[model samples]
Target: MAVSPAPSSGHLPRTSPRSPWDAPPGGAPDPWTPWAGPEALRRQDPELADVLLAELRRQRQDLQLIAAENFTSPAVLAALGSPLANKYAEGYPGARHHGGCEVVDLAERLAVDRATALFGAEHANVQPHSGSSAVLAAYAALLRPGDTVLAMALAQGGHLTHGSPANFSGRWFDFVGYGVDPVTGLIDHDRVRALALAHRPKAIVCGSISYPRHPDYAAFREIADEVDAYLIADAAHPIGLVAGGVAPSPVPYADVVCATTHKVLRGPRGGLVMCPAELAGRMDRAVFPFTQGGAQMHTVAAKAVALGEAATPAFAAYTRQVVANARALAGELSQLGLTVATGGTDTHLITADPAPLGVDGPAARRRCAAAGIVLDVCAVPAPDRPGGCVKGIRLGTAAVTTQGMTEPEMGRIAALLAAALREDAGTRAEVAELTGEFQPYP
Candidate 1:
């Protein structure tokens, strides 16, 4: 590969994105945004620079099917790598414990304002370190250590924080899990109501990691009310869709909504929590003094940038295309003999069993990985029989959609995936050829 140096042009030359496809959300654009890092790092550490270049090549070569990943815009990237990373603001804006918190305070305020407006919530806390951390804060704000919590079963699509024994949620709280209908692959509301009545839990959580449909927020709210339980929505995956108005907003239904800025939101890898005005103090304190310390100011600025971008009509179109692409992939993959969980998806994610193709989930994942079609495997737990489960692969369209691929490309990806699972050695080159036409970063 040949290398060329970026001119030492001042901020005046870097005003706006050259094209709407790579446009920055409106504001004073980042003065230092670059497709790659500044030339200084390449000159200072060529070894580390090689690793970064390799990652760039890999991203451009492989299909990123992981549901939890996306390419942040260069503007967001600039914010994440900004000087705000040097700050140590240990509390909410306007009330930080640190002395020099004035400038970062403005960025945090903007993040909260944009987040609340984007999701139609009364309050927002853009501070928790990750989705799991945000979940922990929601718990700290609303539940006691020994309190009973009713949530989706881990084996049935729930996240680890929904009460996996290996996580803090399970060790500190009593968890009663409600599962989906085995045949339909959808949450059985009757079962959820029954569990709530039987347990009388302090809180009822509504969310999942791999389930392909929206959780019935209204129904969950009703059940929580019947049981006098607080409704906590761990909306880590669908929050971006919510922002784009492609999914139902849980703000009006759930008592606290915990989410990640990174996933479909395409922000920095961090968390945000939103709630009604009454719970604002508890949520803020929970994110700060309770579960975390200083906020990552750089990430906070990046989140603001992403949220602003999400508020645009362009991002809404992007999200719609994401779901469209997911549906196309699901339909084509199922046609190729994989059993798509829930028949298809109402969101950007799809979970499919590859066993009909003569490959289990892990094996299929390896086959795809070898051919550069990266993805993850998940289990669809069956409660009727002891230890009964279905192994499956989980993937999403956010990243590819961000890269501007649509349903036509989705068809090609499906064919390539099926070919890989069938041990076709030519799949790798085909994948590279496809992704090469749709680079992640402009």
Candidate 2:
């Protein structure tokens, strides 16, 4: 057969049409194209897609006041769903067990670099699957089984992983608990020192889940030094604030800092551990071979994106607004006859005992949910009562701040909460109108 005698130098003879896997005339795919979303899920499983869409609608239509919640960016969401999720990188960046970790190594490295930069820490391990896991890893790194640990009381704004009787920490360690002052509803430094001096715990943890004020990390460090204990700051709720420079950082004071990426950081649901450079190896070992297996590379990539976002000036403004909105909400609640814990909030959350409004915490939360305002029931500083008693409602402004609400909007939300607690007939309509004005995902 006569071959095409001579194909032109610039233009070769075409053999076949382009396949779906082939790139376009350009070198790479278009980045702006909508790659994955509800439509893709709908195509695969319509029922699950509907549920997700309904959840999106619910989030858009209702207020989210859960203290440990926030709305992440679309970029972070994209990172969470990226192809990196397909990989299984079982160890730290260069030392991973798997063969195809070059790209995942870059992802994890970027996450670690960004986290360390954001927090001004010596080292970072962005591997733990959740905040609780981060705390577990920190414990594993610092303490041995049956070692004494002094942590805040769970009923007084402390987290379960800090040493609740039902948790692994409590079961494995000899945990001595401290509480905030019943009168101030804030941590009592004297009491903490007393307990630390008395128990001489191996580790002293200072942080809270529902606390509404800035923690005295300096004092905690002093106490820890006096007792020769390792100080751990479980800053799950305030990492974004610390990164933005609007709140005090525990990195300089604590031996190790544990945090969740999603809560205030507004990233994917993941965890981070930052510590002094000297302890980096121990922390990494604890997180990988001890607490968890293969790191979630996708979430680590999302965390890198969030840390990048948080380092910008715009995120600083957002964090400042979050604190302002929280203060405004607490003031409004007090004006509307609610007893705000600590009189008001210095952070992004307001813990209020609704008893002054003639409603229990659970009842107030239910009423607010019915009126399209979401929050969580919390325990107050009631030493006489059991830990399960619903004594307060904890509300946060992180999600609302992400929705672009301000001080004026906080006032309106407080009014809605007040009216809802009282069962006013028009409160639900007001909530619907307000939520329509500020869509969370829009």
Candidate 3:
């Protein structure tokens, strides 16, 4: 393994011109400390400190391509670790069920207001524990149990929570799924329309976890209108892009939109639900005293800080770069003779169905891991098809591109993937050396 010098850390370089894999001071203290534990407790657990330090270093070394992950900013991290974590604000701002929640209520209210401005929604609920939980709350607010719901097919780029048999959406409601066109690998509006007419669902989910193409929310709205269904746009993957005005905003087309604060929003690891003011109270009630108890004030504060950042000009530029980086990565991968799902991506995530490359998702992900390129396997439909064994692999450019990777980096990444897949040990060694060439996340 040839060792190369490290590049500058993305924003604020943590270490000097030294190895990022080095251990942190105080023998690996809890990264989420000063809040999660007492000072005495942290002092008593030095071994646990070592483990966390190693974990952070490991995370820095690997390129996280998983679409669901991101590098939260230190500002947001600081808010999450602040004293707000100790407060137990059990209700909405200015109307809390508990006392001494003035600051905490302010934090939560700020998050709500920021989210509203970011998405231009009539109302925003920044309280759900996560994106899925937000969606669950939306369901509770809009439809009754056993109401028919239409969503995208999981194998064709839908989320498990959308209607997968394993998820709560499926367990509670009658589900009818719509998939993309087989020949074009894109969402088929006509097909979705047909499903809507047949099912007459109470709701239709309009976003996906693995979709590489931009959704036509207007068309989806038409379908929902045809069946009197509420369109819930799960913009978890592209909310940041939409917020930054780089992608289509679902808030206008869908009756409600649910998204995670982290993914593209680059906020705290939480969820947001946006809807008309008429439905806002129902959504809030569904989230609090209905689904969850007290809100996570610290997380809410972090979410507020992140939403503020997203409202800035810099975050828009970052979102734009994320799209550009994804397209570059897809084009470069295609050059490597790898078939990217739908030929490429319209969002941040690229789905590469490696059937033509003579590999399955698990094998390719394993190879990618060995080469220091983190990738994940997606569920592929039709196990009997030539390249169809739930073996699809999905990668995104949000994190690495945010780290400042450009076209040149994409080119290098594609070459590394090709070499790793080919099992060329010598070439693999050369590729491994390149990992150190870039600055690991600080």
Candidate 4:
């Protein structure tokens, strides 16, 4: 895809006038002031409060490109910091193992209901603390110990929970691997089908953390059906796009779907599991007694807030702009002679090897960070010849887009990235200037 030309002045369109706080809650502006308790904490422990405030300042200043990260709304943050964090709800809404559960029950039910509605799933478990836990719970719910499972390979963008040898998912289950075609950098459906038939695995896991294209969930479902394997879609990265109706949902095809609330969903840092009605009981049990003890009610409440925001038309526009910004970034990078994996992005992330610029992934990441552009070192597919680890840097526009950056901003960012790779001294100042204009949480 070609990079869209920016205006002659090199400026992009401004962000939407609609602010998240503009909407009235319950048809009226919230009259209660945002709590000033943080000030009390600042007075009580100046050092710790300074650390928290410093982190917020850092987020406000840096150009965050981390694919796995995003900025949650003030409402979500408020809920996370609420007193519900004091609760110890050890079970589901109606079946808690502790007292004083009435209010927390409402929070969890709201989270579950909103999540189900967002994803069009029959049931949702909002308790898993992170995406890893959600993936583990899904495995526990469907597969017995040592059951054979087929999943995408870690080096090719699959997450650790999918089957990294270091993770419990690999230790507990017999896992076989698949990868994207090296030349195309896309999953080959024929290869997946062949592997499923050959391994005869108990489960097939789809979805990825770094892949920049849309997943073929239906193809995975067809292969799963042919081999009688349960299809698990770990959509931790694209859940917001899926919810916003920009990306195809895995719910209609997969037997189980797992996601984190924080990524593009812009919720608090938490996880969710969704499955068919019949699997709901097992999934709930796996999440509660099997993987976690008590539910994090505060985070659940925050997720409820995010789900509510995601259901709005404004969020849909936000998510679509996220994709547009990603494509612009990828296209601009490629136009500047960088090799963006899969050519360009159809999603919010782009993986580019900086080898052409005479640096490895880690070195490039350090350079970018020094310039105040935050991203991560990632692996690329190496399907043909033997080489050292195929290292690259992964970038995402979710955070920047949330801050209202658009295509011209993407062009500026791409130039900064290039200058960063080249170790140009001026890049840092340029990055700081750009970040100043799109201050997060402002």
Candidate 5:
């Protein structure tokens, strides 16, 4: 395998490879040729393909720690590039707004049915363009405008769609938020119950983007029942683990569940909504016409392919390994004097308070990027109590673990992170060397 160039310190550009679709030196077929979509740049400026190819190579070679990013299988990628992309199949199967969509509709229906089976939901809608779109549809189905909603506070490991003031969910409806217990960095179910009783929200949305533990969907159900509110589980991050029976599933407790097919599911970028039988019609209506039109049939096909994979025993083992890897990484980080949230993780992500290490989330993310590891900058909010600081940086083991990384890899990654924070040049070189051609799950 060939190695990509190393990222330089202090001035590393955001790394991305444009394409990996070309045949290698021996003229053999490129392994990734099937999924490499039409090169928008290659068609317009042929010379740019080299740069894009370099970027793609860098991504494969580097350590991907982004909580929401991963490498999809070639099978799923092939489906994404299929002829389904050309179809404009509006409406459900056998009820399309466009003709010549028979095969496309079948492909999409397969995706919906497979997703329903995978999650054990009564109905599934695989059309929302992204996780945020899927979430909006769920909200639209369950709440009227201005209805009060209870969701996890963003600064405390919640998603933007859950009720961030700057997001559409907060703008369109009245939103109240609950947070993790500051001392333990874990969600306080008692606090959630208190808030639900006080607010009597239309829906209690449960899930997070940076949280380090499995959400208690059953508990959220109890809270919602007490308040006569609906339970919406946005299991976008842990859906794969849930499906593999490694994490507690929300299907039994949630009236509506939303997820993205990427991340741990390892599929093409797309979203899905799974609801109980009672909300089938409303959820469908919310997803269509209300949120979007003309579903991306290609992506839906890819989603079906991925969902099929998720049902396999291998995928189950893969999901378990991801959580195990996360635990290993968290333990190592904690040993390195970083404050890992919740002490450790029950899922594939972990959060650390970088303030004690003399850095902020954005700066830490950039430093990791420069050292050939990628991460997202997370928000930390003000507290009712005084003398609080930002929550810090978040990381995940999904991508690296998928690349066949184990405890040793986790330790190396953690050490690289510490060195990056300390501005140690030797550690960055070691990271680049260790990460060469490290494709997860290939």
Candidate 6:
């Protein structure tokens, strides 16, 4: 095997063999290639192959501004598509229920170690299937069924896992919902503290899906301390930024931090949980036997790759650009007659009301879809007497930044968004023209 020198940047460069594979010294068969012929899959299953390829085309041709999404590196994709997917590792690295787990064990260990290092946590579990799964495990480890917990209200920019009436958390636990300040679109620490004292929750959860500003971990810790509650930080949206050192880490303050690998982390679509050493055992067990079954070894390996990439200087630089691009885009949105939540952003996420531009969030989302501008619709905190009534659009810079877009591109995107919201004809062509310069796959 040839060992080429590492690239100048942290990102692993993708490699492809020539059309003809080289013969071995003993004239042995050629090694397996990363990619099979394009027709190989189509021949077997044309319908599914078309769906997959069409998805690829859609991703490559549109602006991916969804805050919960990002483009994974080719190296990470390679890991996801590797033979490790065949393994059924059911437990942690050292202990497994299945045989032939030795190799996959090392992959899991690598993922755990890299995750801990990336976010400066004492312990990490990289096996949970998704961010929601990670949070479920965190709750399982810390609280019993029916224990009173405080979490952001779902209508107030909180995630579904955070006390949604439709989720397990809402059903199994006695949850007290908190909301952001009606005027500022930011969390009101005073109100949260009051709620904590009033409810005396067993745990206080701090995190959100659409909130644009960074959470005050220390403040939440203090409030939780006063109430004798475990503090759980659902950092699914900001973990990638935290890894890049562009955002504050919750590992130090929250008893357990739950995150997703995909968002800004630019890894596989998986979940990660980090905590202090004392809680490691419970967190692991919760993820393994309690919430989920066999671990997806391939996703674990991809997470390891992503965590390593995140620790690199280049990834840090990329995260910084992600934030900068978000701030610039928020300004552009504000100038284009949109009411930007918090007036601007401190992270890769931006929440704005397109109602000022003659379309509500859902309408704007439909229009943006027609224009091939990918983003999400979210519930915004009512900027008046806070009960959650306003609907708005949410955008993230991670995906576009991953495509090598910058502030100027953000302005163009915001312009395109405005034109689309206004129902201008021929806006999708402009969007296609812009996206053509930044193909996510190419």
Question: Candidates' TM-scores?
Answer: 0.92, 0.91, 0.88, 0.91, 0.88, 0.92
Off by over 4 Å in 2: 1-34, 382-390
lDDT tens digits, residue span 1-442, model 5: 2334434432224345634434345644333333334443364556777886787777776778988988888788678776577789878888888998877777887898899888888999999999999999998888988999998877676788977779998789888889887777778999999999998999999998887788888789999999999999998999988878899989989999999999999888889899888889999999987989998998999999999999999999998899989999999988988777778999988888666577777888777778877887775433443534374787888888778888888998898998888777776678777777466533
Cα lDDT tens digits for candidate 1, 267-381? 9999999999999999888888989899999999999999999999999999999999999999999999988988999999999888889988999999999999999999864
Between candidates 4 and 5, which one is better according to TM-score? Answer: 4
Per-residue lDDT of model 4, residues 238-311, tens digit only: 89899888899999999999999998999999899999999999999999898889988889999999999999
Model 6 alpha-carbon drift over 4 Å, by segment: 1-34, 37-39, 384-386
lDDT string, candidate 3, 84-138, tens digits: 8889888899888999887677787788899888888999988888988989998
Candidates' C-alpha lDDT: 0.89, 0.87, 0.81, 0.88, 0.82, 0.88
Clashing pairs in 4: none
Which residue pairs show backbone clashes in model 5? 16-55, 17-55, 17-56, 18-52, 402-440, 403-440
Put down candidate 6 lDDT per residue, 1-442, tens digits, no spaces: 2336546543235466533333345634333333342444565567998999999999988878899899999889889877688898888777899998888888888888888777779999999999999999999998899999999988888788888789999899998889887778789999999999999999999999988999999999999999899999999999899989999999899999999999999999989999999998998889889999999999999999999999999999999999999999999999999999888999999998887888888999999999999889998766563455578899999999999899999999999999999889999999999989998888
Worst 10 residues of 1 by lDDT: 28-37
Query: What lDDT does candidate 4 reach at residue 436?
Result: 90
Query: Pick by lDDT: which candidate is best?
Result: 1
| Model 5, residue 352: C-alpha shift (Å) | 0.4
- What number of backbone clashes does candidate 4 have, counting pairs of residues 3 or more apart or in separate chains? 0
lDDT of 3 at 222: 92
Could you tell me how far off, in angstroms, the CA of residue 359 lies in candidate 5 after the best superposition? 2.2
